[model samples]
Target: MKILVTGANGFLGRNLVEQLRNQGYDELLLCDRNTSESELEQFSQEAEFVYHLAGVNRPKKETEFIKGNTEFTEKLLHLLNENPNNPAVMFASSVQAELSNPYGESKKKAESFVQAYGEKNQTPVAIYRFPNLFGKWCKPNYNSVIATFCHNIARDIPVQVNNTETELTVAYIDDVVKELISLLEKSSFNETSVLYEITPTYKVKLGELVNLINTFKESRNDLSVPQLNQNLTKKMYSTYLSYLPEDDFSYDLTMHVDDRGSFTEFIRTPDRGQLSVNISKPGIVKGNHWHHTKNEKFLVVSGQGVIRFRKIGSDNIIEYFVSERKLEVVDIPVGYTHNIENLGESNMVTLMWVNEPFDSQHPDTYYTEV
Candidate 1:
């Protein structure tokens, strides 16, 4: 099917067009500002589906809003009328259309033209009144506060929140794209004028949104990442990473080094515990201590080592020789004193996962010989 996407270089249009291509739709006639009026006329004649996404969101003059939005929409729908295909339309309206502002007024007018065209042609018209949209490729400091926050917060740039309690509704770009594509399966339209809402929209306070995004940067140092299982946090986290400056993509991981090689904390979780990398010098013995409640799993990633364990009042010593040559994990159980000795000529690297983050106040650790 031939599809025509207006504002093809725009944030929503680019995302929607790319997803359509990914789903095996290649006959897409993308019309941007640079595309000639004749090209759009030709595309309008052939397109079976139309994504009316072009609009003047922020204009210097209020009149430009009408010309870019309402007037342009009328011209395209008129061209669509000259064709016999009667292409269905998915109009990208904003929730702002509910307001009395000039931009909103223009969008509301454009929605009417789209509704009339759909009725005249007997085709489905999907008027999506989207809330603030945010994801990759959205211009920072333009329309989306989430995009601005993610971009600025990722770079340590200051973000001002006049009212911390101000709540805003936002929709992820991927979610919007998926929902628009799913409309293709919808063949029935009970009426000509229908308002469509994007499902799974998220609500976030200004302060909370900033705080959550800040944790993404702090995760590198504290290793305390956001709860990604939560859909909103997961989506915001992905959007935050995409706006990171190319040169600042990588950050330094703090490493604690002494005579016994170096130890670096990789990741930490509230309920799942922490992962750390331990490097031991040749002949170095580490972890001559046992935890009362914190259990751990140790896997040797390099060199050779022997992890020895002894129960607190038992004389029996259990030992497991490990090396990178063969992969295996040795679980350190509670109430047992354990130690790992680097028995190789080179440094031994061990990856460790503990059941909890380290607490200096209530460190369940007690030094003992194993």
Candidate 2:
């Protein structure tokens, strides 16, 4: 199908167009601010569907709202009216349309035009009133607080909250794009519907939102992974990472080094325990310890190593030979003292996952010769 997308360079427009291309919709009429009138005329005639996403959200002059929004929408509909296809229209409106401001008034007017054109031509039409939206590629510090907060906080910039109790309804850009793509397919819902709402919107308070974003910044130093079980947090975390400065992609981890080698914590989770990397030099041995309630899995990824195990009070010793040539995991069972020794001429590197994070007060580990 030939789909025409206005504001094709915008956040939502870019996301929607990318998915369309991925889904094999090769015939796309991408109309940006610089698109010529003659080209738009040709696109309007050839398009089978129109995503009217072009609009002015934060124009410097208030008069530009009507020029970019209402007037432009009328012109597009006029061009499409002359075509034989009578293509379906999907209008992206805002919740602020209910207000009397200039931006809202312009959107309200554009919505009226789309509805009338659909009624007169008897073509598919839908008007979606979106709430605040956030995701990667959204510009920061304009109208979206979520984007602004995510961008500013990721860079250690101060964020101001006007009211602690201020609540916001936000939608993830991926969700919105998914919904829009579904609407374009032949299996659409209520083709002539005047109003449609997207699902899975998150409502968050200003104070709580600020606190959640702050924790993401603090996670680097604490080595604590933020909880992503919730959708809002998952989306916010993704958006936050996208706003990070290009030069700040990597972070330094604290490494405990000794004659044996170096041990560094890779990831720390509250419920999922911890992951660490252990490096041992040639002829070096590490991890002569036993745990009561803790368990671990060690995977040797480089060089050759030997793992030895013995019960706390037992004398029988069990040994397992491991090498980088054959990747394997050795589980450390409770009540068994364990140790890994480098058997190769080169250094041995292993990845370790423990059942719980290491706590100085309750280490749960007891050193023993294995």
By TM-score, the best candidate is: 2
Compose the digit string of candidate 2's lDDT tens values, residues 39-92. Answer: 999999999999999999999999999999999999999999998999999999
Q: List where candidate 1 sits over 4 angstroms from the true fold.
A: 187-193, 343-346
TM-score of 1: 0.92
Tens-place lDDT digits, model 1, residues 198-297: 8889999999999999889888778887887899999999999999999988878889999889999998899999999999999999988988899999
Question: For each candidate, how many residue pairs have backbone atoms clashing (under 3 Å)?
Answer: 0, 0
Q: lDDT score, residue 242, model 2?
A: 88
The parts of candidate 2 lying over 4 Å away from their true place are none
Q: List TM-scores for all candidates, in order.
A: 0.92, 0.97
Give the range where candidate 2 is weakest over 10 consecutive residues by summed lDDT.
184-193
State the RMSD for candidate 2: 1.4
